[model samples]
Target: MSGRSAAARVDEADYIVVGAGSAGAALAARLTEDPDVTVLLLEAGAPDTALELHVPAAFSKLFRGPFDWNYDTVPQPALEDRTVYWPRGKTLGGSSSLNAMMWVRGFAADYDEWADAAGPAWSWEALVPYFRRVERTEDPADPTQGAAGAQPIEHQRDPRPQTAAFLDAAREAGHRVTAANLPAGQGFSRTMVSQHRGSRSSTADAYLRPANGRPNLRVVTGALVRRVTFEAGPDDPAVPRATGVYLEIDGITRHARARREVILCGGAVNTPQLLLLSGIGPAEHLGERGIRIVAHSPEVGEGLRDHLVAGLAPAARGGTLYAAEKPAELANYLLRRRGMLTSNVAEAYGFVRTAVADRIGMAADLPDIEIIFASAPYVGEGLVPLPAEGLTVGAILLRPRSRGTIRLASTDPRDKPLIDPGYLSDADGIDAETLRAGLAACEELIDTDAMRTVTTGGWIQPAGGEHMTPVERAELAMRRYSHTLYHPVGTARMGTDSSSVVDPALRVRGVSGLRVADASVMPNLIRGHTNAPAIVIGEVAADLLRGRSSSR
Candidate 1:
């Protein structure tokens, strides 16, 4: 990937992918594998050259920093009217560069619902090949695991003793020990991270950077895509098609045309925001903002779903990952990329069905909540600094019932969009009740003999909830301490329904030569982390585009 001078410009390419993120990087690299297809990859942020980006334990340091798109949501009603902060990666690897790097595939039923919404092509069985195609696991002989793939995913090499205790506590609390990526298992396992030899394996490192030198691929950094440009031929005035992007490069506005298609890989938030900015969203919302609407698609920024977690942190008897912040650990990381520096913070996790699931009429087969056990206090959604040596047990609602919206604060491309996650605002109050149950479950796990062996103090954040009832304590803790798990999806959902922004093939419904290939197209929230599945989405999108391009 030769660096281009600020004055350099590419007038056109066979394909243009906006956002050189987890999905975009993979898509661009895969498309360029066909030497005939010239691809232009545009990234808003500068190159990811910082040392901390590759270090696993340093992920939280990037939050709200220069590399983060540091967005905040509208005040939520259920959580004491608190505004939540969201950290999205702005660099070449996107959020993959900034995220905890946990590799989770979600449940099989999650894709079954996707297939039901889209087609059989998105079924769990159908997506296995793409999953395998995107991941390189440690076990080559294992049929379920990938042997040789672009992304490196490995089991936690050296889990902290506290992590093992959490797993033991989970077992004592009635959950089973499960495989790393089992779709049906409602139990605990050490986290599988997107890393190789202990360092982060962001899509930039796994796919884009390795493939950047290819003659067919041109990567442009610090290019902020303002809007997608659509044009019509003189012969077909009514049928306007996506032509390229209007981008800002080093303070200069430039246009880059696409000969084939313009793909949006800007994830759930930015993709919808860009679509609205490009005049392709609901008519009334666009009109209200005094912006012209090219496509009156009502579902452009609707159906926003995300996972919200309430942290239950107990002071630990043993030392926490906070010790890794010292200079000696830095030396260890620099020398061998091992030790506490390799920790993803969220060291172990489990899926569990709480009693509230039956009350809320949730599916029995689907887990209602996820417990991510961090070796340190991951408070304030990893935004707040750790106060002391503690173990954090995060109770995450797997599938929220409430829906939210992403709206335009204004037409300005530089302005951040209005993000309203509508967290715990389900009319039926199911979301809140389910989360309350999850909190109770977390308390149960913490109170177990296994956890008691490692923990030192009582509830850290709730302050005085020790004497309160489990339900009351859960309610208090949830109301005062809940935050996003950073897994927002479904802003521009893909479905067969007319309300969907994209079709089953991921093409924008009202626009030709344009498609969304990221979390924004998810019809529903999945049951696990989004990183690995997002890479798979890119692989599937590349195949979909290639199939159509080949036919033509």
Candidate 2:
């Protein structure tokens, strides 16, 4: 059976924003604020009306469900040919609706690096305002943190005792407890999430929902954009102008014309996929797929980067989040909006520079690894259900040296892209060695008396890791158990260099009336989760649209 309906009539709008996701939702809302601009936002998934979408703890349940794109990468050689499952939200808020709800702003130095790759306007100082504009944080350590922005960021309302123990263990292990959002932020802290009270505050909830009533704004769900429709420029026949998008809505093929611009916020994966499908990627690749070349951009799906984590689970003494699966916990969530259901799984996070990174002369401003503490055992890279009552402490590589690619599987838009996240493929093996150090830190943290008190039984993941040297165990575990943290970026990286798919202004090279404002345009992966930065990118796009000279 066909996934879409029969062809429908053409639609027209002043502007068309593809993918009502983390960036699209915000950008569409911001653009429509002008009232003069009639904006149409298209989403491939259904609306975010499900109760589970708002419940923090239920995020994992949405995976492989109707709301997820449910993408799986090609077999990774470094991870023993494991084809990692990559879950991206197919709903209005994109992955923001399905993410762990972390609101990390990323390290300042990471943005500085972006500035180097793109332009000075992308520096930390220039982007901070956009960060503040997108967030409404509560009780942030820095006064500069957003206090009254569209998205609500709240401290964890109900942190697990196991997580508290993990923090103490981190401190005992000589790790400082610092804020993850500040320039000098580092250390262990309860995670701050994009939530309102206890409910998940997705971009849909924060930006799109509020602008839902606008007459100038129109949101259509279940609209699959196949390709960007282009026309030859008036004077320059060689240059193409994106007039609109060719999409399938209600199984009906239709054209949604954009009078002004067609902005793509389809995230790191889909944005590049759409570009490639529209024949905007590598000439040879598109030719092989029988796709007519509209624009030949060789770097479209290159430079893919993602975070990988080694699971470090230990059996817990008593209290774990498993009890939340019961009826009583659901009742607690219904009545008081508190309990395990309010948890965002990975409830605590920290950034650290391991001895390996420091000794290797890596950038001191960037963290080599990030420690994530989950109240419950998250096995099988969170694809597997909780096996038992336990605590999970993951050692995540922050800045992996390896790069990957997203390529066309076929000319058909329905076909999934070929994802090759060349993880741990660095020539120097630095990515693997850095992860080893992080896993060692995880071992050090868990071995502390503070963590040991909460941990009762033996290690759940990499059972009996203590037998071998910590580095050896980490290497084994990394090869055996390392999986994506679900933060992928840089596929359609923005820069001034010839290899860049998009310029610093986010305009696709050799194309007009088209722009990309999403994680895909990030020149470098931030030293944090991609959610906050993605939203900030939307804010920056809005500012640019409003005729701002630069982000600063």
Candidate 3:
């Protein structure tokens, strides 16, 4: 059920933030720190009280459930015309609650790339303090990692035996094994997770929960935001000022007026959808849906990018997470917080500078591929359990040249947006070539002595035996069995150019009193995971909004 009905009637606030997910939760919490500012956070889903949400290894169980947005992509021609499953969190913490919880900050050079697009303020140098301000790492060995912040991050308390073997293989294969989230952003290591005392610590737990006692903060769950309410700007009538939002709480439609600003943190998928629904998208696209155009922004839902991974699950001997759900293991987890249940599935990760486009100077020294090790068979897109004992070696394309879009499916707010990641559809074929190189690395890792100790030496996934050639296997993995790492960004790209959806400060270019603070505003993708970066975006957005003296 939705939250308190009495608060549904409570409307006006100093600030209105939509989608109490990663960015919105952190922003609303930080905004209310003023005590004088009244902040309203509207979530389209239920509370983050699900038992599955708190369990580190139970993340896949939340997929396709009520707690998930459960989106699917249009059939991709490059991927054997298979529609990929895209599971976004629909709860308080948003995807952070449902993610594998890896706190991987990409290389310093990658954020320097952000400096090229946006301003130097987004550079790795300038954003490091914001990154530091977002996380409270349990024991940060690296100077780049934050030691005192809201988010709780730590090394896994109990990783699977196979996970350690995976890192051993990385080192044995001559890959550097180093600490996580270093500014250099090279090498392999045991993943640092967003957890506290072996339990998942989402933005809801880290940011929102602590701020709940504040008198000025009102968090509304199950509140479906329909569209942004706007009026004529005082300075320019052609430019609209976001007055507030029109949302449905329970059954009745209500208006929540924002005296200062309206921020959209619905993420890469929903933020663009909400913007398009509010008549702030392409003039022709809004015309097709019979929506009145408020702004003619053409780039609202364009430039969608995500991390596409091809997972290879090989048959394994005993000692994997295959028995993590057994009664004794559950008891071990509940009693002492030590067991396989504390595993984040994808336990260890490494970066690879593939041979593709390296000599040509295309993305030189940047990680073009990522290697992920999960000590379980992540078959059926995680819709089912590990049928037998197996370990997954996932090869992910780190820098995708392919860009897609998130478009409106219908005028109704309930209808999910049309998401087309266009996986591996890059014109130069570099994306496909990079993934093939990642597949070769996975094969190399699997052949190492460290990995040979655990595996039984056969394929469990790709729906076949180990009879296929390496070339054939790599091609098959690319054509099929590929899924998202759940890092979608760059839809509402932030840049210094006028063509960008939002400015470097994250304000919507043609709108007043409106901004987007989510993965959607990323000018481009990072070389690592998106969860930590999304939280950092929220932290920076809070500072920017606080510094503003007048409406645009």
Candidate 4:
């Protein structure tokens, strides 16, 4: 599939899935399984089967490169007036190729809240089979699990010494360490990566590549979708029903009709933007932009949520860190698929309650914050090499109460949308008490006997010192070190209400033959990294399109 000329007015298909990312790949693979269902997948970026994408540690290089969309957020007032950089995948595998390969299932209660918020079928108990179906866990047949049906899920084979040390430190800090993706009561543990052997198993590698040769599937790269074209009646003042998509490839415009459905898998930001561009958002906002108002769905691009993380670097012993520049290490990885090349950096993590009680307080079974420990610091500010020897830990606040919005920059599809995460802007807004408690947890872990062995002084901001008062430290932490956990969701939310862009069945409200199958459809943010759940959404959407019950 190389150097293929753009064909004008391409052939029609049973389904047109946009964005060959995590969700799109899964949906395409599942839909094409039925040979009768012709599926056409459109991707704005080219294929990335490069060695760089396969190496787990090389993910840093992929960011802001040709494969990435390279988006930036408006200045976030909460983080000391800093503008955060958001790197999303625009390639064949989408963000999965560029993301940390941690296979977190979030918390069980996370899905229960989904059911309560979105609909009943979204609950943990109801969605467990889908999770299990799409996962081939490293340890299967334990009744607790097994890897049998979908993608391969395994623990890192030779975790960096620092990863083990971090786990030991957590134990020393009086926090129980357990497997990260287990059932709710199993407690906290190291992350189980979505890896097959030593290589990163991106959605393209796991699902798309294998389906490449299928006669029923046609994957067109470098095609940028401008808007969904609707079939309209002459006298009707209402929005037309979507029957196809208008796209451009190599300076040529074309349209492909979908007999069954046009699925938008362009991710959170792009999905909402596409809908608004198609004239299906807030009536006033659309009309103000000189665009025709369609459905008038006020919530088309509302309810944006993301995980905010803060990084902490601690001293490390010599010979512990993996230096990719070293000849010996690079050769080892290149020849044997071992050494630093296989490392996903963020190899260990744990979920714990920052406060004594749950943040929601309705259930006794949930954890508030999740701490992700990396062997090396791969932060948004770029990779900061440790001082000859040091390690870093990232504390992420999952399930933030803060909400944001995604609005169109203009009617042009090429123009990137305005993504305002509005981080930490909750009704209560920046909670000093919760942040201080989180800091205390971090302090406890660093003060542990295991961590003390390699310790230097604490590296808290504010520059006054680690001994700064809790108030001072909290203020400094808030201002100095907040960053994205890379998990963004809830832009095009799903609900039964009229304001929602999509209904519970994942179908667009007031739009015919169109649906959204990606993180954007999530009514609320899940409690962990969203990569795995995003893939599951694609799988479920495929089943629904094939007339299978979502309960399956």
Candidate 5:
């Protein structure tokens, strides 16, 4: 093992990207295309070339293990005083490798809303080309869709029998099912996952690994960035420019200089926390904490948001749905990369608009809730102890009405930050209502001729002949099973306003030679999973840094 001291290598690079996760990998790969530019990517986690990472069925195993930065949230009020566990990947690919691999390009209007809130360049019309550039959609040249890029997007192979039955039930419930990514009408549809053949196509696999061999790119693992080092000129007291970063490795601290820019790709929580730790947040807050205030930006850690979902455990007709049951299926996966192991568990999905979207005149494209039909329920707590049998249908509220924040529990980077995602905090919060709609939709499936053959009974919480009304069931569901969609964003929002941390160009407010190119820059949460959009942000930011004029 070659352990180089950070102090010995205080060399400068054209760019220093913190957090070698999804956005960081893409940004590093794109920027290093120019052979003259030297790029250094620092990650707190190890690399992701393990065979376990390649096996699609082993995703859950990666959670809370060495690869994951397992952080627990404060007890959520809406979740019956339950502290939700957040498993973010701390490896080379970050959450992209550990995630369920659901490839969701958020609603078209979600980007349009960005444009409406921030600037014209962020609109769907502006960002679609970039989305297309980063992804190789499975169904290319379908007019409404196409795939011609690095990331491979495809439909699940050998979906479970229960998946097909669930779709049939959704159809019988009077919802429309379609093959499109952002399908029309309300109902269930198959999920389009981020997989090529059978392996997960993470940004690390698609972008970083290929670029790793380049001489100009240097990747340092297990390097935890502590704070941004600043230089204060005698004349300028308010604007202290960031020249480098203070990073810790194996209990030793060192500084790495950035000649051009220091990009923060540390996701929502860590990004804002980093800024605050570096004295770049609200003046009063930092001053009260006995820290010098460099930039008094109030929005550094405000406007935090995330997607919330309620999991519904349905009764299975027979034994468990573990992929290990089918030996031949496993053999096919190990041999030719084709089998049940290749399937992303949330095989079928549907997007529907609740009453809230109706009031807003949201189009069919703007789906608020995404219902995932899985072959089996992901039972057991904290990523361990698999259940012997059962099925799970997850109802995710894409456009959450509630907001939360991420603050420093202390200045120590080792200590987990305070994450408070105020789920179901809306009077018009669509979580409860949307979940009821999902339950109704699921019941519709149970009643269908196809599902009747498999489903033996109902397992709605507070079970049995109890006089619990639908409203009561919905509320109970919200309390019992509402977990994170793992899509946390908007803590360090980008806009042209004073409250914004970064501007439209992703330049951090009141700072030079620094930018943020990650999900944290989102002004609001996109109406779907965030991996695709985070990649798009990196792609677009690369173009901007390369001096390319905006086509939008």
Candidate 6:
């Protein structure tokens, strides 16, 4: 509550970072490592004080709750005009606190693709050190996994027995059971989570908590940044220099001046929305909003991509997350910290190269689908709790060909943006085809003897089971069951080209003294979960500002 009763009329800092979630928390913490440096991290939501936030299996209970941004997409034509729920975290750790905690790093080629768009600085080899700097893997099976980093990356302490059955089903279904997050060809493995003991270890817990006592670092919660306040560039008046931000805290408007630079760590949705509100996006869009144009970056909110997951939940016999909140389980979790409550719903996952991607000659290393195993019925997009015990096998479209946009609905900063992921809107219908292949894979897993042993022959998701035709089943899954896996990227894409929103160094084009250090800057969405990469981005941004040169 530092911001609730502070007498900060005009707060000043060396670096002003907007949105103290995954990236901002780490960035502010790392920057303040130098005693001389000063940093101000602004978070719109309150602290991570929710009791449910500490419980891994209770993550879904936060969806659309106070801690979540509670965003929704514009009706998608391809999705039968369903307004898909897109829940983002509004609190200290941001989405990382609300996520399933899957620590998936994807493949080397994904970062190499980023290198192709930006520079060698973004290549997998170049980013490995940053990963090492951010992750402290408790169980490092591979030499590549980090051992001495800021965040705790540990395997799930108490994954469900049904989760193990799902992995066995993968093997029974003719899939290789290998370690997850492999640089190339990731196979089935229990998900490594961002946890410590049994509680969630978000960026707030990992970076901010450790740096709380730093005098030079100031963290202001419940601070909603309205726009970036700019001044005439030091060199030229035509170009604007980001001097600070205009933020609102508890209905009081305040100006926090940045002496050196302003960094946007607002993630994919908020970053572009802030830019457009500040007249830094497309000139036409700004004109329509009656906002003065500060920059003409047309691609600020374009190139939207996300991992879409459709789940098939079958009724289970017993021993699922359904009883996680039972009295006995609650007591066990509270006292021993060893129970279903410690389970990060999605306990196991793997990457699979679908026939659809192979037909298009996609890279062998870049899989088209990701299979996720959950111990509970993850239906209704985790918003509605099912009454019965069930197991979920989620099929994720890893590399979606379709593009989308994030645009302003109104000039008000509080109004949510129009999120149009345009899922399965490709001209050739390849995106839909790829998802169909993924659905078939999900069916294969559920049909296995190992899966059959755990799950009863009853279906919980789609009322109809094996009676529907393959094409009909896939159509049903795509139209009715698919939802976002919470990974959205490329809204403020960075690349070597001029049209890109930011350059290779993550500096915003057409503006100086401003940079973006979140998933919004990614030129392309990786094949894995975005949490690991997002934290690494903050670490890399810290090095970028500190002038710590990278060898790769």
lDDT of 4 by residue, 244-317 (tens): 89988987788889887799999998899988998888888899888776677888888888887766665555
Candidate 5: C-alpha RMSD after superposition: 2.9
* Tens-digit lDDT string for candidate 3 (136-249): 997787887889889999989998888889999998999999988888847998999999989999999999989988889888888899999999999999899999999997
Clashes of each: 0, 4, 0, 7, 5, 0
**CA lDDT, candidate 4, residue 430:** 40
Pairs in clash, predicted candidate 3 = none
- Distance from true position, residue 182, model 3, in Å? 0.6
Please report how far candidate 2 places residue 426 from its true position, in Å: 0.8
Q: How well does each candidate superpose onto the true structure, as a TM-score?
A: 0.96, 0.96, 0.97, 0.94, 0.92, 0.98
TM-score-better candidate, 1 vs 4? 1
Off by over 4 Å in 3: 1-7, 548-552
> Ten-residue segment with the worst summed lDDT in candidate 3?
1-10
TM-score of 1: 0.96
How far in Å is the alpha carbon of 142 misplaced in model 3?
1.6
Total backbone clashes of model 2? 4
lDDT of 5 at 241: 76
In order, candidate lDDTs are 0.86, 0.86, 0.89, 0.77, 0.77, 0.88
Backbone clash pairs in model 5 (N, Cα, C under 3 Å; residues 3+ apart or in different chains), count: 5
lDDT ranking, high to low: 3, 6, 1, 2, 4, 5
Residue clash pairs of candidate 4: 136-147, 137-147, 140-145, 140-146, 178-188, 178-189, 316-390
Candidate 1 lDDT, 381-491, residue by residue in tens: 677778878888878999898999999998888899999999988888888888888888888898999998898756665655566677777886688788888899999
Give per-residue CA lDDT, model 2, range 1-552, as digits (tens). 011123323488888899988999999899889989888888888888889988999988898999999899999999999999899999889999999998777778889999999998899888877877877889867855878789999988888898888888888988888765776656778899888889999898889878878878888888899999999976787899999999887667888899988999998899999999887999999999899899899999999999998877888887789787899889999999898899998988888888888888987656888999998988876777888888888888888889999998887778889999999999999998898888888888888999989987476776775566667667767998888888899989999897799898888998888999999999887788999889888988887877864334
Worst 10 residues of 4 by lDDT: 1-10
The positional error of residue 121 in candidate 4, measured at the CA in angstroms, is 1.9
Q: What's the CA error at residue 213 for candidate 6, in Å?
A: 0.1
